[model samples]
Target: GAGVSQTPSNKVTEKGKYVELRCDPISGHTALYWYRQSLGQGPEFLIYFQGTGAADDSGLPNDRFFAVRPEGSVSTLKIQRTERGDSAVYLCASSPGTGVRSGANVLTFGAGSRLTVL
Candidate 1:
């Protein structure tokens, strides 16, 4: 795919279940990000990878959530003990690289993976 790809476009899980979301960034892109969006609200940042390592993960709410970008291309977001409050649309985005401080970098977002916790 020329753009980011998110797997399991939609997922329904019972409370306490564990879920893993996958994302494949555009070829050659070195910057990847994960975000979650609740109804009627903007997406909330989850984590970001500058290459094969995480550049920032402070947006993660707690230890129950984790993400990894091994080899600097494919990434996965893991959620433990899913709760109803965790239900939301998870979005993945990528950029060629973090541009200069001039702010010219633009991110391309995937269609998103919707998760429902019942």
Candidate 2:
């Protein structure tokens, strides 16, 4: 993809339902990240992947939230037994590499997927 792309720009679901959000990163990028943003708040990092391995998953709220980057290009975020509090925007970002010092890791974000719990 030319830029980061996210699927299902908006989603609405009942509390306790499961949902999956998808991301397609820019071509040849090797670092991917997932973040969550509530209304009026900055994005909160959830997970980061360097290649196929998750380099950072410390920010995930709980086991109910999970993500995977199988080929280092496309990623999926899965939420199980979603709660009303989980309603928010799911953002995906990609970088050329995972080197924090490198400008390539600065992050390019997708428009994000908005999840609504009813």
Candidate 3:
């Protein structure tokens, strides 16, 4: 089966611009996640979706960041009023189900969509 897929591998925009990043998860996967990695920083969890609803969204930085998975297969992350600080590689991942294995969550990640806010 296909793995996770993200669109627009790279995006460059000026501050205050809005951007939408898309992700397509693997077939039959019920768990999906989004993470952001800033320069020199490890990827941080942004949100997690189980099916069509967001299960955990506390990681979102602010109201400017939002995500949706209306059909439980494709997800879109929407960023409003982008800023330089928001520049980073936005990664999308999916898993077979929700579980902590030996204290670590296993997931299959996309190459990522690098967003550059100038």
Candidate 4:
């Protein structure tokens, strides 16, 4: 894929159902990130993976939310016990690295998976 690709561009599920959103970052990108965007708020970071390990996951709202990048190129975000409040657009992004010193923090975002809890 030339850019980040997300599955199920739109997902409608009932409360309490589980949802898994998949993200495939561009080849060669080592940094993968997951974010959530509510109605009007900007994207909120959920997790960041550099390589096969999660570099930061403190933004995960709870234990029900988990993300993984087993091979460092593809990632999946799983949400359990979905609630109405969970309705939002799940976004995935990728970059070369954190960009702190390398100045490559630029991120390319996926089209996003809009999850609507009914």
**Clashes per model (N, Cα, C within 3 A):** 0, 0, 0, 0
Worst 10 residues of 4 by lDDT: 97-106
lDDT of 3 by residue, 31-116 (tens): 99999999999999999999999999999999999999999999999999999999999999998877557225569999999999
Per-residue lDDT of candidate 1, residues 1-118 (tens digit): 6888999899999999999999999999899999999999999999999999998999999998999887899999999999999999999999888757614778999999999999
* Global Cα lDDT for candidate 2: 0.93
Give a tens-digit lDDT track for model 4, residues 1-118: 7999999899999999999999999899898999999999999999999999999999999998999888878999999999999999999999888655845478999999999999
Q: Cα lDDT of all candidates, in order?
A: 0.93, 0.93, 0.94, 0.93
Candidate 1: residue pairs that collide: none
Give the runs in model 4 whose Cα sits over 4 Å from its true position. Answer: none
Candidate 4 has a TM-score of 0.95
TM-score of 2: 0.95
Alpha-carbon RMSD, each predicted model: 1.1, 1.2, 1.8, 1.2
After superposition, candidate 2 runs with Cα above 4 Å error: none
Candidate 1 residue spans exceeding 4 A from truth: none
TM-score of each: 0.96, 0.95, 0.93, 0.95
Candidate 1 TM-score versus the reference = 0.96
